[model samples]
Target: MENLKYMQAIVVDKPIGPSGLRLVNDYPVPEIGANDILVQVKAVGLNRADLIQSYSKYNPPPGSICPDIIGLEYAGIVVRVGSRVVNFKIGDRVFGLVASAAMGQYLCTHSQTAILIPQDLDFEVAASLPEAFITAYDALVLQAGVKLNQSVLISAIGSSVGLAALQIAKLYNCIVVGSSRTPDKLKLAQNIGLNFGFTVESGSFVQSVLEYTRQIGVDNVLELVGGNYLKQDIECCSYRACIVIIGLLAGIKTEVNLALILAKRIRIYGTTLRSRDLSEKIELANVFASEILPLVKSGKLKPFITKVYSLKDLHLAFNDLESNKYAGKLILNWS
Candidate 1:
């Protein structure tokens, strides 16, 4: 362990609506356990999960120590190591997803879940990679079993997770189709190597997708919007298609055609990052290190960070994320 006594962080006494920022100050620094390493946080990534948690909708597991600090992933330098820790030491750079309490100055993480940051990567970009990239990898490779030459469609393509899915699909040589509600975002996605982009507001999303695939529907659909678009997603999916639901930005309730699902043999599954156990998170970290991290180090995979805010300005950061004016990731910097 290095010379460290206390650290600064953001805290929320009580979460109200998204109207005002609720971050507080001078929260105590965490201590390292036998298998944990204390990290001096440099940058933290913000996700929709933070927004949901702050709205009093998503709660952490029972017996959680800190319930008000709402952050999932971060990147930083290790400042102290526990007795049983082996993979990391003080001064090493690392990044990973945490259960909670990451929107602060220092965080203690299990050694197994923390991946060493690549030498070529910046802290801000590394912070943006973990949550969204891991979720995309899990959905496309682990759950969907997407292979080479398959057709994959991703909705809400302007989001960080959506962009990560598009990049991962392209890496596996799959044909990628991206959708957004705005023409500028669609054009931006196309410019960034997405093969096909469609505007959902114009109401020809299914037609554009069919034309792109020559009437053969996409083999896999990563559905981020879950309300009225559920039926549309089912309609555009191919026979025996795998549709993984990862978000409900549009709304939750939807009336779908069950007959179409049965007739086409479509499979639908819903998943989230915050609800997984420690073992599952360790496995995800290992898979990402072996199969995904190298791509980022090689410059094949890149994260686009559109905005960054200091830890004290968390409310402004959340406001920007909720406003949907940005196209990439919004991050919180401790420095």
Candidate 2:
């Protein structure tokens, strides 16, 4: 440990520009606080949040490592633990979310938020789990009160978080309808037990959804495409249905029918993991550790990693993600 001094981290040179991400050597290793643990990062998950931050649309929360490093999730080996930390020790494999600065060779996070990596999970796969899965779980299960035999409609079904929502809803025996602009992604979503997978070329997906539910409308909607889908989502919801807005891959501004919301008594929630307080994040972590980790260990829940890139090739990885050609999470490996 004494021999390790400098670290390598991905830093955004131009946050407000279209693209300016690079790996920086000779970065200072972060110091661990009494409740924190230092991890030697093995892999980092690529997320749309990362891109949004790179473009200066989003900023890191207070207490993040630095302003330039934009990653939100990572998995690695625990190299050292703080004196007050009791749940983890040196050599434990762990994965978790961070507010920022995680796409580095080393990272530091509070011990309470980092979960022990299951024995059966690989480093790359583990790295992909936290951000997408937690967003899905928190939005659908915790906030929206999804129940067994209910119906859910997910837009952008090819996204990592959308797939996670589909699987978790299915785990509770919920009927799921997924829509994607890409026909191939719709087919893949169908193979993963989607009750209805349709291409969202236009408003036709709403008709397909109405036909599938016999015109009753869905009980829940995981709305990832934020623009026109917002209005369509309102049209397709059942009475008192919950709609959780987890992404804005489409444009953020959209007009919704206020009368429909009032008539249907719809509950709309917009959430992002990066801006939550420390206590809230810790609570989320505990819930994931107790409720979701076992499912992952048993193979009932899994991370969908469609592509892998070395840390040096991060620019190409970002390009690939922006192309919207991939169906699942993209991972960047440090080793």
Q: Per model, how many backbone clashes are there?
A: 0, 0
Question: Evaluated with lDDT, which candidate comes out highest?
Answer: 2
List candidate 2 segments past 4 Å from native: 16-19
lDDT of 2 at 123: 90
> Candidate 2 clashing pairs?
none
Q: List the residue pairs that clash in candidate 1.
A: none
Q: Determine which window of 10 residues in candidate 1 has minimal summed lDDT.
A: 17-26
- TM per candidate comes to 0.94, 0.97
Error of 1 at 252 (Å): 1.4
Worst 10 residues of 2 by lDDT: 13-22
Give one digit per residue, the lDDT tens place, for model 2 in 98-203: 9998887889899999999988888999999888889999999998999999999999988999889889999999999999999988888888889898887765
| Local distance difference test scores for all models | 0.84, 0.88
| Candidate 1 local lDDT, 208-323, one digit each (tens) | 88888898899999998778777778888999999999889989998999999999999998888776887898999999899889898887887879888886677788888888
